[model samples]
Target chain A: MLDRIRIVLIGTSHPGNIGAAARAMKTMGLSQLAVVAPRCDPRDGEAFARSSGAEDILEAMQQFETLEAAVTDCTLVVGASARSRTLPWPLCSPRELSASLPGELSGSDTGLALVFGREDVGLSNSELQRCHRHVHIPTSEHYSSLNLAAAVQVLAYECRQAWLTTTPVTSPEPFGVEWDNPLASHADTERLFEHLERTLINIGFHDPDNPRQLMARLRRLLLRSRMDSMELNILRGILTRIERHGDPNGNDHPR
Target chain B: MLDRIRIVLIGTSHPGNIGAAARAMKTMGLSQLAVVAPRCDPRDGEAFARSSGAEDILEAMQQFETLEAAVTDCTLVVGASARSRTLPWPLCSPRELSASLPGELSGSDTGLALVFGREDVGLSNSELQRCHRHVHIPTSEHYSSLNLAAAVQVLAYECRQAWLTTTPVTSPEPFGVEWDNPLASHADTERLFEHLERTLINIGFHDPDNPRQLMARLRRLLLRSRMDSMELNILRGILTRIERHGDPNGNDHPR
Candidate 1:
């Protein structure tokens, strides 16, 4: 998967970021490198100095005249940009981008390219539009600007983590005491809500005719609390018993 | 818990970062903010401008002369740093630090403090020592230097998640599935070894007169797996059944 992914740098002014990006890619087991009209020579002494023994990546770098040329053979193109644009293309965080890569590129001959923009001004709206997806690295709202290499490093690292930690079963059960079987179900919740509404009206805490807003808010709060089945059953049982004792009319409750 | 958590920024150079940190804290439902010898005025126009409606956090912020003064009442202090030091103090990742915090500060009068360092050099060795624990955010080796407020946001978010998700239980079960009973108990493990030793001697797997090396290796393997009670009982039951079927003395009749 790493070999199938190519990192494309567009109009990069700093040769050091080119080298750093190579180093970042190599550290995460990625080697394919593409540079599009770099302002400085990638093979320059400064670039090699910052490459930090990642000369193999620098040596194998491919130069292209345009972003489209670099991504010509690529099936899935992800543009790295912090700025949000008016375009309706899918926007992804770095974590989201990493997660989406493997399935998009698996067993396919087409290359997957992650395109980064210029240092001073990031990818223009038109340039970002050429790619299928845009990825943003979340930073502080005060100073969201991230150096090109730093952004590349974050993306590459997340990609490697996503690949290495792919498991047959990824999600863990909810963190708490797990019962062999739930003591209650969705039907129980509805029954409890109705009982609670009656109780609230009896206690004068709710207006009988227009009580939807308060009940909805209470339901949301309970849902967010993540009550286990047994707990829900206990609360519902209490409410049902209360309703039984305090009926104003001689009408039996609906099943 | 949020009120108890005092976010102390030491020698913060950027007013914008201070404001951003406040915003991060507020978003995570933390309110206590402390500034230690900030280089820029926290009330500056730029700071308020960048705060983006988190002006209340800045308005309520406390200014301190020193880091120690800021954290004097704190019972648990966590210092954030990307760099590892030669110090002998306990070091934890952000996850570990988050796990340890809830019990240490909650329900007690003790204050909890999260100290962030200077934007450029980060916390000096002396300043870092004042903290009871240190946290490192996992980042790419290529460029591990994270923006000050970005680091703050990550840590605050993690801390809030930890606090919100903690279930108040007298005894929480270990991670993994909820078993009917543990695979092995502490006492079962101790007894299993004794039974195994006697069986080994009867079968001549261990010398009755002199035995140490082989037994030591076997003990090491058993301890390494952290065998639980149920597993030990099953193994012992199997061993006993095997012994009854086969005897070293070659007895023809059942004893």
Candidate 2:
């Protein structure tokens, strides 16, 4: 899904930004780069310096005279806009774009274009109209101006996350991750809760008669935490110490 | 949550990157920064210039001689990495990191450290082991190198998003932040599972030959939610009760 996606930079004012954007794309598992009517040379010294060893991406980047020509093969063109216009486009957050990307990338020949405009001014009204959707990165109202490269990084990162969900990687396990250790089983968790209830009662910390919201809050806390085996052991060790010595700070002297 | 998160850069080579990182942090509403034995002076002209009007953060930055000194008050230390080392730490993507961050932050006094290593070598093995968790920003296998400022920006953005959750969030959750609680450390969670599988097999609930989907489902359930210390104690107590009684339904009776 990531491979089918193309990153388009339209009339970028600075070559350094192009390089930085390329670097950002590479860091987020993106390679296909296209430049439509770029103002500066992407292979210049500033670009090379800014790329930080992602010259390969800049070298292989496709250059076209027009945005339409660049995204001619793309079925879905998502323009990145910094502002809301008089006529609103299908604007959503970067995360929303990621969620809907898989469905759009389903077609074999379907290409998805993530078009970024010039550093000074974003996509033109006509340019944005040619696109299928628009994504706005939420920032503080005080300083909402995000750097072109930073914006690219955010969007690229989102695409990679979304791609991980859609396609299974050949190298790593599903979602490119599989835990080396197992999580605490449901049965064990239930037992831990009982042990906790007992320990609390013994230590005069909790009253079973008027349990109140203690157990519920604890359940919410533990259930949310998803304790692993070792954490359970550590907590159990502490609890056992408390039960034996009735000392809350008996954690330092372990058996 | 964002205020409690400290961005620690250890032995950074470039002063400019530090300034840029500070800029990124300021943009994302993060201020706490700790530099452990940096190669270049953060107060240098380059750092100030790179900060881009975020000199207040740079001016208020904390300096330390060692990683230990920097994170003395922190309970949960998470390292960011770009490479896969011989010793694989508890690795997760940035999105996952952001989701689990809020619960950990609920303990008002507990501090969480987001440690970034040297530009070239990253966090050392010992440094990583000292850390409770690790996060890897998913990058392209071909060119996975990430700029220090860019890396900081991504994490700061995530932390800002996570922080938004604990406080009354002004904006809707991007990617739907379903945080129940903070996750247990890898070591602790492992012990709970080992103890669980042993007890279940002992009590005739599981056969080692045909483990079935019981454990898998349990894992999904546990990992889906976060658990806290008291919750772990409660669950462990219940497990102990079952171990003693050799009865899956012996949860009601006290030991």
Candidate 3:
């Protein structure tokens, strides 16, 4: 389960921070690292220098062009951000986020991605929308400038602490008792959002030209529900049926 | 209470670590930082650069020649160490340490010193002996080389989390139901240890030549009890009486 927990850094400016983040992750027993369109070259010598003995994690790190690509396979995607966001999103402390992991990642195939944003500017609104939940580390009101690697270190430490104390269930318990379906991956959730959006637009219920946080609200609602694979299929099937019913030249191909 | 939590680094070789540590402390609302026998100049350019915006903390940092001098005023002294020691000591996780802080720092005069040792080699046996309790951050078994600043970040983060969640008590409450005396400071505890050791030697109960682990065991016992000032005075008076009774050339000085 620790191996399944990935630390993803997006648009990181400093290679040293990348290296230090790797070191931090390794110290917490998290080996999977992914980078999404980093501003600095993560393979720079400074990265290895800062990595100390965690060069193995750096060497084995996975790089992607976008956050969606980075966390497409992850079942749970959490973004680390400051508390000054104007957008109302699901916010939780690192401790709360970690406490939910035992149940969240109970399935063998269920993986989690802890996403960190750029040093100067945090996750953009679109990038944040992709995350299932946002984690805010409570810093001082006087000084809230937490360094990039330091943020990673704090969250990774929480995850490790939670992992150490939790006893792993030998049999996979799917959140609720006797539920057999695997949790929906990021890709699965994203596809559902797209289908829902298109169906809404076709039915004239949502106007894409003058979108007023409608999709964002729906995304929040669905993400909070944490739909399993079977639930996702049912929702997508409903979306397809709606599209067929609303569209003038639509053929019903829903399974 | 946060300001009273002093982060003490002993024999830190890297100025960058000192700067990063200051940044970490500031993020967690901790302002007091003390360094004992640092190998590198904490005011070096690297430290300031690493501090980012927390230079004020670095500028206001205190320096000391010894750990004793650093934490003499503190009521609680906790050392951060790895778990490979042959000697038995009271060990706790970062969470457990934070959980104890509410009651521990309830007094107006009570302060805590979180001691971190050298980067390469952690706290020495003598340094460990000075601490009332040792905190061990659970890290990966394969790579336990946690960066000094990262360690600071984790502990500081925990302290902040504890602070944020706990409601402050309007009035200070003693540990016991009706205990009126304040907790003993590190200086007071040190004096008690010295007096206890001398009395033991005088009474022929403990030999200085073959000291073994007698002092360490006694220190652990006294530290665990968390004696109040009045309790400390009573114990010291008892030791003085024992010395007078056991010593050949002792003068009677009754308190």
Candidate 4:
């Protein structure tokens, strides 16, 4: 799903930002980058310097003289906007754009282009009109403009996050992740609670007649803790120890 | 709510990255900036130049000697981690951290600190342990380390997105939530851990000599639970009772 989405930079002025943008995209697992009518050479020294370890992405970048040529193969073109209220095109947040990607580019061959405008002026009215939709990153009203590379980072991050939901990396296991022992079952938890309540009363820490939400609060905490079988056994062992210590007989038989 | 969130950079080596981070935060409506023992002067020319128009945030940046000092007042401290599977700390996604902000910072006095470590080395194990939770930004497994500014941009952007869409919940209080008590502060939680360690040792449930990841497992469980002050107090009371009852004299003492 991430591979189907290409990052398109339109009329990008700074060569360094282009490299930085590539680095940003690569960090989020994006490979395809397209430049439309860049003002400067995209492969300048500063571009390589800013590309960090992502020089391969910069080397493979596709360049075109016009937006039409750049995204001619794309089935969905969403222009990145600065949240302009006057635009007639349907505007979506970066999250919304990410959410719509799996469906919009459902086919393996279908390509989607996310077009970012120049740092100073952004996309021209004609360029904006050509997009299928506009995706806007919400920014502070006081300082609305975001650096080109930073904007790309946010969008690419969102796309990666959304894409992760579509694929099954590892089957979702019960919580208590990587525990050596199995997570305590519901019945085990209930039995532990009963034993805990009895021990608490035996130790005079809890009063049954006026419980006053003590057991309820303990239940809430322990349930949220999500203990595994080992941790549960440890707690139960501790409770038994306290019960024996408090008992006058110090025997197996309960009073 | 955004105002309560502070971005703390630890041992940052570059002035330019500092400036870029400020710009990233300000673009997302986050103004608070704190630095722990930065390697370079944060107010250098490169920092100011890279800050773009977010110079005010850079100008007002707070300097600290250590991570503890940087986040002393914050009730919640979340670290940006590179998704190391061996870590015992509770790990959350950026969106999960953002979604939790409203509920975690429900009180007016509550504050949150998002800590980013040294650009090259990332957070030390000790520094990572200080955080109540660790937030990992999903990136390509091949090139997981994000540029410090890019990581800040991604996290800050999610915070802004979550803030914009948040509506106060009119629904009844959810289970495990205590309305009256604020979430336990970092200091409070630390004290609880100290007390817990001592109590476990006193009860012979744990041995300090051969500590086999016992405390780490317990820490992971309790931190995931996210105890409020009242619940924390209740647990402390229970510990004190057990300690006293186990003593032969039933004296007012920890031992």
Q: Judged by TM-score, which candidate is best?
A: 4
For model 4, what fraction of the real interface contacts is kept?
A: 0.57
Q: What is the C-alpha lDDT of each candidate?
A: 0.67, 0.75, 0.81, 0.85
Q: What is the lDDT of candidate 3?
A: 0.81
lDDT of 2 by residue, A1-255 (tens): 888889999999888889999899988888899999989887788987898888888999999999999999999899998888999778888878889988988888999999998878889999999988888876655555577888899889889889888766555422234544456788888888888778777655578899887888777666655566655654565456446443324443232
Q: Which ten-residue region of model 4 chain A has the weakest summed lDDT?
A: A171-180
Give the best candidate by lDDT: 4
| DockQ of predictions, in order shown | 0.02, 0.19, 0.15, 0.51
TM-score for each predicted model, relative to the true structure: 0.44, 0.68, 0.80, 0.87
Fnat, model by model in order, equals: 0.00, 0.34, 0.42, 0.57
Per-prediction RMSD in angstroms?
A: 21.4, 9.9, 26.8, 3.9
Question: Given the true complex, what DockQ would model 1 score?
Answer: 0.02
- The candidate scoring highest on DockQ is 4
Q: Which stretches in model 2 have alpha-carbon errors above 4 Å?
A: A169-255, B164-255
Q: Please report how far candidate 1 places residue A186 from its true position, in Å.
A: 38
Interface RMSD of each: 22.5, 9.2, 29.3, 2.9
**RMSD of candidate 2 to the true fold?**
9.9
Q: What is the TM-score (0 to 1) of candidate 4?
A: 0.87
lDDT value for candidate 1?
A: 0.67
Worst ten in a row by lDDT for model 4 chain B: B169-178
> Between 1 and 4, whose lDDT is larger?
4
lDDT of 3 at A33: 95
Clash counts for all predictions: 8, 32, 0, 0
Ranking by TM-score: 4, 3, 2, 1
Give per-residue CA lDDT, model 4, range A1-255, as digits (tens): 888889999988999999899999999999999999899999999999999989989988999989999898899999998957474789898888888877887886799999999999999899999999998899998998699999999999988987888888664344312435667999999999999999877667888999999999989889977778877887788788777655557664343
